[model samples]
Target: MYYGKIIGGVLGLLVLGPIGLILGLIVGHLFDNGLMQTLKFASPQNIARIKQSFFETTFLLSGYLAKADGHISRQEVDHTEAVIAQMGLNAEQRKRAIELFKRGSAADFQPEPAISAFMEICRGQRQLCQTLLFFLISLALADHKIEAAERQALQRLATGLGFNAAQLEQMLRMAQAQGHFHGSSGFEAQPGTRLEDAYTALGVDPDVDDKTLKRAYRKLMSENHPDKLIARGVPEDMIKLATERSQEIQAAYEMIKKSRE
Candidate 1:
């Protein structure tokens, strides 16, 4: 349930007018019941409408994410098409995905209601949610660089998913370490020796004034709070990673504070 998909679906319904609205309700109803019971609860017409809305949302979100880094690269477009292919969507669904992408691209990709809908879907579908998250992280890292704005966007999405600070931090760390292998090679050096690197990873500067340092610390703490982590579906095993990162950040800030005194 990517936020882009949810947004695209809703927008598609709006464009399709009354006919689309009716279809959405019908499909939604069918989805509420098991597939075996789908026939009992919804008509073919309603099913078609639901399918339309679903694909529309998918395309919209994809387009939005593509535009997130300023311009849509050829790589991003290919990545999106790949996802659509994997979906095994029929002709109509594919058309809908394309249409949604057009609309999302036209709209300059502001993310809001789309993100909310995505979070709701995540709450209901754990495995799908995780898969979607993995895809998003991959997309974010696709260019071999994670932009600050992209990271902010992810943090906002994580919050919408009810992720506590701890959970968000863990996700951020994992996402940041995406291409790197585990073990010492991939491991960030110990904080003392690699203090500068640690600060950079945390998006902070050691030379900042105390007030700025405190502000950055608070911002990081709020974003990575444990409560937020649990909400975002972070496994218990990974929570420690976040806790440890936070401790390191706190320790660094303290060291800076002590030196300034």
Candidate 2:
């Protein structure tokens, strides 16, 4: 049976606590269920609109998340630069991204409008919404310091993006687990990769049955498959991110499989 809902439901519990260990599994679950077959953006114009909105909202909310802790830190700035680099954006795109980021970081910037617009555009597309939430969560945790203010901001963003607090927590955990599984090579475990993180990366409990574990692994892989994401209207730039995420899931599953054997 498909395990996406099972994984997401379990991970949702983590958003209720700090160091959320439940995020990725839920997102993986939501996307792997073939729900995206209903996508309506088949026209070039529609696809372009989705891409533009997705890109703009991403940087805007990323800026909002960065400025959540009162002041934007150098690490956050560097992280944003790294994200831009990974996207390999052209000069015009980079400029627009920078401009949106600056606007979002302004003291009076309101994220509701952008969030609402994105929500409306992606009305039936849970995968796209979750992916955007995933990106913002990554930016929020970039500094490795999730202050109370930042945490609240994250919750707000989650709610604004049509997710509940539990779902936000799940996404947070999944994002954190990615750090453990991804490095310069994109899928290499960092030094001292922990078993706990491996489990978290897959959004499963340590004591999960082998059958369930395999289902969770398959669910995540199917969810993050690049072609699947593209069909769901995820920006092309995010395909690399999704591919790397799949790598992390695979690495995590491998770790679990080895330990069991």
| Each model's backbone clash number | 15, 7
Task: For residues 1-261, write the lDDT of model 2, one tens digit per residue.
Answer: 346655665576566542233565556566764554344456566767777788899999888888888999998999899888998999999999999999998999999999999877766477888888877877777777688999998888888877998878887887788678877766767899889898998888899999999999998888888887787678898687777778888888888888999
User: Global lDDT of each model?
Assistant: 0.55, 0.81
C-alpha RMSD between model 1 and the true structure: 16.5
RMSD values, in order shown: 16.5, 13.7
| CA deviation > 4 Å runs, candidate 1 | 1-56, 118-127, 164-166, 172-261
TM-score of each: 0.43, 0.81
For residues 1-261, could you state the per-residue lDDT of candidate 1 as single tens digits?
233334445655897976775666556545554554444324555434433333444466656666666777777777677666755667986787788877766645665677566544333344334334545655666666767766676666555545655766665564453223212443334423444544554456667766777787787666556666544444333344455445555655554555678
Cα error, candidate 2, residue 41 (Å): 4.1
Q: What's the distance in Å from true for residue 35, model 1?
A: 18
| Candidate 2 residue pairs in clash (backbone atoms < 3 Å) | 4-29, 8-26, 15-169, 20-173, 22-170, 23-170, 23-171
- What C-alpha lDDT, on a 0 to 100 scale, does residue 35 get in candidate 2? 56
TM-score, candidate number 2: 0.81
